[model samples]
Target chain A: MNRFLWLVRREIWEHKAIWVAPAIVIGCLVLLMLTGNVHLGPFTDMSGEAGLGVVPDDLQVKLLVIVYAGLALVVSMIMGIVGFFYSLDALYADRRDRSVLFWKSLPLSDAETVLSKFAVATVVIPMVALGASMVAQLVVAAGGSARFAIEGLPAAAMWRPEALFGGFTVTFLRCLTAMLWYAPIIGYLMLASAWAPRGPFLWAVLPAVGLWIGERVIVGSTFVGDFISSRLFGLYGVLSSRAEAGFEDGEGLEGLRNVDLVGSLRDFYASPELWFGLLAAGLLLLGAIWVRRYRDETS
Target chain B: MGELIVARGLGKSFGSTRALDDVNFRVESGRIVGLIGPNGAGKTTALKALLGLTRFEGGLSVLGLNPHLQRHRLMQDVCFIADVAVLPRWIRVSQLIDFVAAAHPRFRREICEQFLARSDVRRTSRVRELSKGMVTQLHLALVMAIDAKLLVLDEPTLGLDILMRRQFYETLLNEYFDEQRTILVTTHQVEEVEHILTDLLFIDRGRIVLDAAMDQVQEQYAQVSVRPEHLAAARSHQPIAERQGLGRTHMLFRGADRVALERLGEVGVPSVADLFVAVIQGARA
Candidate 1:
């Protein structure tokens, strides 16, 4: 385990360019919080929007919630991109730098090598991103609190300034839960790195596009739209429509309408869509391992 | 007394072309065997097979472990430096050290540091910033730190100049080498390694052409430079290879009577290059 951690640390330490993508994403989030048109004062003060004169405290809280959720989504997407490269680049970098020979010369096995890459992509990188998000949110939340306190607002609302830190932590956990949902994709990228001779990114991404296109072409005779929708988002179009209805009619998290954290995790796991992704990812990874095992060093 | 490595009738092919053909070799503990071959020879393939880096049709073993079935175990006892110096260009020296220290149980940090200290390689410097010679040094330092039984280096100093090559050999000889540690070094520069080699194997066209101790090879082979008038006598002796230069005939003879050759005409010690050419041609014939 310590050796695995060292592998992750080495990857993090060696590729300084990798840090740049996440830093840029985090920087953008901070920049948005600092300069966005939304009233920062209302979010800072323990007081709700009831005193703001225009918007109700509950409504203000909902807007803030959306903003925070959007921030989390954007951050997660950035990490996906970064994490994808992290996983994919791990194996190829050795070949690129010719260090494949060096590392292979070590006592480490191919399984260990591939697994360490998976661990970094699935576990270590998310932890780093989460830590960064926590620090960034605290600074942002603290600044807002100071602003709200100076304004001396009369009535507090549903948005709790104290909960911002809690929200950050919860969001990180949610993203981590979401990563379990995407583990195979991360693994697939790794396999692609091992399998392809040139442009692994293209190798990784092109297949999804090709499959989508192939699905459309194959289904053009019977159910064209259904195939397109399923390929676009792993969920069936009708099921997604029902889920969205449930979300909108939701008291939006109050009065028996709230999506509990564990419930969300359960719902995501129960979907056949997630299982299919896992299976597809497994096959891709197996293929990649096969390529590595028999790879010609001369090439 | 156990063998550290063994290969029997190993063969590899790329499409219709055979890259390695029925090559057999072995290394026991406490010996430095030189793997000498010309360009396009199967030296790299044979080494890669031993390291489990490439797949071959026949049998290969490292420390009694089959390369295919027990590659990880074999790797634990074996180390290899490929024909090229390959290190991550973006990685800093210090970070590389930390990585190796973390990954391998046998990696010796103190030894690596000592080697690094002797040179001007900066801890913060990225690999891309270093020269080819420096890269070789870095590679050697890392591999030397691993306490493996077999150390296989393929053309380790391909791009290095004389001074750098000398320094590399010196460091390898003084710091890391021992009889208990078996080494298989492949090189085109057979002349440079003549003194250090304990045993020599000449490989050509993916086969072992000649395998002999250095002393026996010296004793069995002779270079005879005969006058133009005595050329017929030298030819009658069945020299391995012959050339005419400046009205004199130079020929390399193996298993020939040297004293008789000296009495018949001029005779001297055969250069490794002369011997290699003669051996390769002889094997082909």
Candidate 2:
């Protein structure tokens, strides 16, 4: 376990994008909150009393939930991009640089090494993004609280800032849920990383794309497309399966408590989509470990 | 001393190209064995199989463990320095120490630090920040810190300047090697390592051309600087190889009586480099 942790740490040490992507995203989020210049057309804040209010406090909270959760999405997206590219790069880079032997020289087994990479993609990146989201929300909430007090607005008049933390809890859980949901996808990326003789990114993606197209042209149905769609977007399957309340109505002004951003996570957790995705991920990860062990281009 | 490495009839192929073929060798405790071969020879491939970095067809055991099946277990007792491989460029010196400490149970961080303390490498500097020579120093410091029984080096000092390269082996000899430890090294510059080699194996085109203890090489083989008057006599003895240089003939002989050869011309032990050339050319001929 300690050895695995160190391998994961090595991944973090090597890839700055894991932290940098979320930092940049949250930085933009905080900057928007500080100046109160968040204007998103219909979801604008109603509080002109602070100044020219473009985004509503409640909607902005939802937007904050969105941005916060969206950052989770963005972070997960960035992390997905990061993970996909990383998985492809990790196996190739070591061999290309001939550093595979260096790591191989260590006592850690190839399974442990490959598992550590999968853990980084599925576990560490999300945790870092979650931690970043939590921090960003806390700062924004605290900064908003200070600004409201200076403006002489009573605590009662302000949007409940506690919801930012609450919303981020949901976002944090959602990130975990996304990790569970996208495990197979990331697993495929990792498998391609280990197995591909060249350009693992293409190796990872082309087969899936070919499957999606081949199913359509040959089978003459969108049914195969839907499964690929659902396999990639289990979050939507969880979300659309429910009758969404406040934000789902699409009309707009709702209090901070009304933001049901990650409410579907409970339902998401119980669904077979998560488990099936995880099962596929586990198999793909095993394939990756097997490939890492057997594939040696050095000779 | 117990055998640290034993390989018999080892073979590996990359597509149709035989990278290693029918390779057989052994290294016992406390011996420095040089796996000498020219470019495209199986030196690197043989080392890779022993290290379990690649798979092979025949029997191979390193430190009494089947390398391919139990490589991680084998690695616990083995350390390797392949200059062709990179120590991840983004890792800091301190992080490298930390990671190794966690991954390798035998790795001693304090020993690594002690070694690093003498070098110019900074604890916080990323590997990319270090110079090429310093990276090798850092790599050496890390590998030397491991209490490994077998140290495999494949082109460990390929690109360093002469002085740094000399320092590399000198440090290995002085600081790391011991009676309990064995080293298997493959280098292009045979002269640099010939002095320290206890046994030598010459490979060509994936075949083991020669395998002998260093002393055995000196005893069984002799080079004669053929005098013009004795050129006929030396040629009649059926020298294994003859090279014409400096307006004189140099003949390499195998299993010929040393005293008899001395009567024909100046007889001396052939350098490993020259011997390698002779064996390779001889095989081709």
Chain B TM-score for the candidates in order: 0.93, 0.96
On lDDT, the candidate that comes out on top is 2
Clashing pairs in 2: A44-A55, A44-A56, A45-A55, A45-A56, A98-B85
lDDT of 1 by residue, A1-299 (tens): 78767776777776554567667766765676566433443243434554444545454554454445445555666676688677778777777757787777777767767776777777776776676666555545544544455566532332366345445645665666656666777777888899767778898778766776676688654354454344434422322233345556676334213323234455666777678867876776676676666687663
Q: Model 1: residues >4 Å from true position, as ranges?
A: A29-65, A146-162, A218-247, A250-263, A279-283
CA displacement after TM-score superposition, residue A192 of candidate 2 (Å)? 1.1
Interface RMSD, candidates in the order listed: 1.5, 1.4
Instruction: Count steric clashes of candidate 2.
Output: 5
Q: What is the lDDT of residue A148 in candidate 2?
A: 55
Clashing pairs in 1: A47-A156, A48-A156, A48-A157
Fnat values, one per model, are 0.88, 0.80
Model 2's CAPRI class?
A: medium
| Model 1: per-residue Cα lDDT over B122-176, one tens digit each | 8989898998888888888888888988888888888889998788777777777
Query: Runs in model 2 with CA error above 4 Å?
Result: A39-45, A48-84, A143-162, A240-263
Candidate that scores best on TM-score: 2
Query: Candidate 2: deviation at residue B276, Å?
Result: 1.1
Tens-place lDDT per residue, model 2, A244-279, is 555465454443345465556677877777788788
Give residue B90's lDDT in candidate 2 (0 to 100): 72
